[model samples]
Target: MKACLILLLLAAVLPVSAQQLPVDAVKGDYIVGALQLPEAGVLELQSPDGQLLRRQAAPAGESEFRFVALQSGRYRAGLASPQSQGRVWLTEQRPLEAQLPEVAAPEAPLASPKLRALANELGAGTPAFWAAVQASGAPWIEPIPDHPQSWQVSFLWRGDASTRSVRLFWPVRQGDQERFARLPGTDVWHYSVRLPSGTRLAYQLAPDVPQLKGAGRQAQRRAILARVQADPLNLRRWAAGTPALGGFDNIQAEHSLLELPGAPPEPWLEPRAEVPRGRVEHLRFQSQQLGNERRLTVYLPAQKSAEALPLLLLFDEDAYVTRVPTTTILDNLIASGRIPPLMAVLVGNPTRESRSEELPCNPRFADMMAGELLPWLAARYPVTREAGRTVVAGSSYGGLASAWLALRHPERFGRVLSLSGSFWWAPARPPGFVAGGLDDAAEGEWLTRQYVAAPRSDVVFYLSPGLLERSAPSDGPGILETNRHLRDVLMARGQRVIYREFAGGHDYVNWRSELAEGLIALLGAP
Candidate 1:
């Protein structure tokens, strides 16, 4: 009788402070929270991984919750009796500027006592429960904070038979291994990992059994087909589906795109009604060197064509046109006279394997661009043949190819815009394979030594590195390190090198800005 009276007294007094707390919080900041409850109850705090960290009793009123986060990540705080919860981010310490709200109660259950009871079991404030709900009956990835420089991406999958493990096709993971955690008492799987800011990554999730490792390509692909899925929770997707490659069929294989915070703004990516737009011509022709037909996207500036207009050959043509907003950028740059009126030919790769095969320091690819593609473009368009007026540009592997083209055929492509170039490539070592391991001097130092051994002139190079590009598998030395090494080598060889670094990852999101900067620096009118 005394306990029931106390509970009634507490419930009446707890509902008075019905204010919502500030959602944003940093590590080590004290949070003064409020919970209107029928009685005093225990509040539980959980880590990002769902590990119970602390539990303490709170009175039915405004209460002080002190926190000191040792690391930067996401955390969950909730109370038991009324069952209310909230999310907190522990980054750099900052003052709380918002008011706390009354603790919320669990939703009244309708049917499915099992699910309802489970929902009550896992606090509504818990990331685990929220992740499962957002997945909408499919695998999901929910980033803790919408805009985070370093993100803790939570992966969720509901349990089912025939699946042993879920694997991620991400580069930074250790040994491309599968790591998943199952939720207690629920048919749900989860895993979380931290990634740097502005990382534009395309990845797929696959359910695999150990037996599939030794299976044939067709068999493995069949198994993969049953399991591989784009993150259901992540709304952003890669612009296009990656075509088939290396006999493994996934004709419509689409990967999910995760764009971390701090991507450099490419103002030209959006079409501005005020800015004059350029013309895009889609052209296709047979390539004698590659033994296949290829597609081209040519951007013609708004300015009237000249008898000898400078030309820029951009690899990964489709991506630049659709993803980078190339035409819009050209229109703006040409209108403002930041760069001279020039023609740009975007060359598309037929397949992922073909792109990888051709874009890396390949002599045949260089020959194809200089001997076949250039002449074909010049025949139809009034473009300059002078090397000084010609530019070869690309990002990542294409960046490596751009530098290789200028070095091999300076008479054709005299200017190179290499954004996050794979300078770690070498004649002896295949990309990403550590033959004898990291001790091999040829890792990222390959291309830099080539320039040291046989220096070339008449080529003006624009080298840009993303600050967040710390490592890549095939390149050995990673993205940023390789670009820096190449820059140092170019400077030492007395080459005219324009080197710059931007705040981003080794992604197109970062390269878009570098592309604009490089063009203006190399082709800008005085």
Candidate 2:
């Protein structure tokens, strides 16, 4: 029993008129209770330990008091004069409300001409309309006659009386959920998007998602995951029984695959029967500079050469090895002579915390890579010592670290292949520094400014960021914007740069294909 409850029981000798109202609330809930007091008195809010938290003045007769439960715990409100008491239990559940967007009526102007014509002819949300959609399959894709490079993709959902809203969950721009508008007097809910012809991604659909009112916007938006599932109408999916190319296990957690006609083919992802396979050796490497140990995976090419082989160092070892099929890609590239036979070192992080600490332009991490890691590899393998033959590559923060390493020690890493590099990162600011507030002048794009100030180095860069990675207003510049800025800065300084933007997001699926392209661009056989 709580100390507050013990105190309340001990004070039972005082005359009580009416029972106090008990409250069951969620965290962030506004809790209100009424006390039947004979005369005006003070109500004290106490913690579980019987310590007074706050006091509120209660009027005579029926007195009311309110409290905002910011955290999950048991609290007590008691009137000292009448000895009436109330208990409140606050849970961790987020307070949710209905925040659904108003749906467009059937008579409203539909974005797609097909949807408009269908609505006018057969009336949307009817049995006939659903039959037609089922026959044609979803999401209904149509070619834009005027714009050959783009396609109109419409997502559809069938809802019942209980369904409040629907959302499309995809690797969309900055990971925003797309809302579906319901048709009046019908079960049909639809959302249409114009995507590039080369768009390839996986998506899920959430129906009747709970809208959190008291939580942050991101928390409310993520509530869709409770009801998110693969689109039933979408025939293609990324799940079990599919080729082992970095996919999911079960259908419940699966996502529907969306590959447009013009999407680039992922040729090197699968292991080929004809191609010679490379050997992957896993070893635990202890770093003296960072005072930690991590796993390092080395890939030895199938074909052995007399001279020292070119070296490729990649960050996020498990991801590149498993999700990306990096060794298979290397085998295909080497066997086809698209790129020369080279050894690759996939570096793993000791922990998630260490990765966040070290990979964001940390000089100690750069020192460890150049001084300790590379020398250790050189002693074990016949890897090239020349900088031109050495390439450092990664995605996201790993990408940022790759650029930073190359920039700091150009003689160690001559080429940097950064996919979706986070150039928006700056040095750690003092506590309580808002992201884009008044003190934001020296905040973002730290690495970009460093390249501008530092002397020109003999380094080449292959940088790529997804077009969908545009930053929100509050986040300063995002990966796409910051990467473009970095590219421009490098080119202005007469540095060799090969930059490209794909119609995708910050996803591993896109990075897998881009990795092969980057390797072929930088180290392809001449």
The model with the greatest TM-score is 2
How much lDDT does candidate 1 score?
0.61
Instruction: For each candidate, give its TM-score against the true structure.
Output: 0.61, 0.74
TM-score of structure candidate 1: 0.61
Best by lDDT: 2
RMSD of 1: 22.1
lDDT of 1 by residue, 1-526 (tens): 4534533454454333322222233543332233433323455556656676545443322233434332346655566434553322221222222112212212222223333454688653266765656755423223455644565555555555534466664323233333565545444555666655555555666554222322364443333332355666666675432222222222233456666566546665566787777788988867887786667889888788646889989887645764576778788888878888899998876543466667777677788889999898889988999999998999877888899888779889999999888676665555433221223454445657767888468799999877656663643566788788888888888899999877555555556667888999899975
lDDT of 2 by residue, 1-526 (tens): 3533433443452233234323334444444444544333456666545566555543333433445443456666665545544322222222322233324323223567887788778878788887887877788778998999999998888888866678887765544567787776678888888888888777888775654434486555545544567898888886412111111111124578887878888998888999999998988899987788888889999998998999999997756765577899999999999999999999876653466667778887888999999999999999999999999999988899899999889999999999998798886654222221113554888889999999999899999998777876666788899999999999999999999888787667788899999999999965
Pairs of residues clashing in candidate 2: none
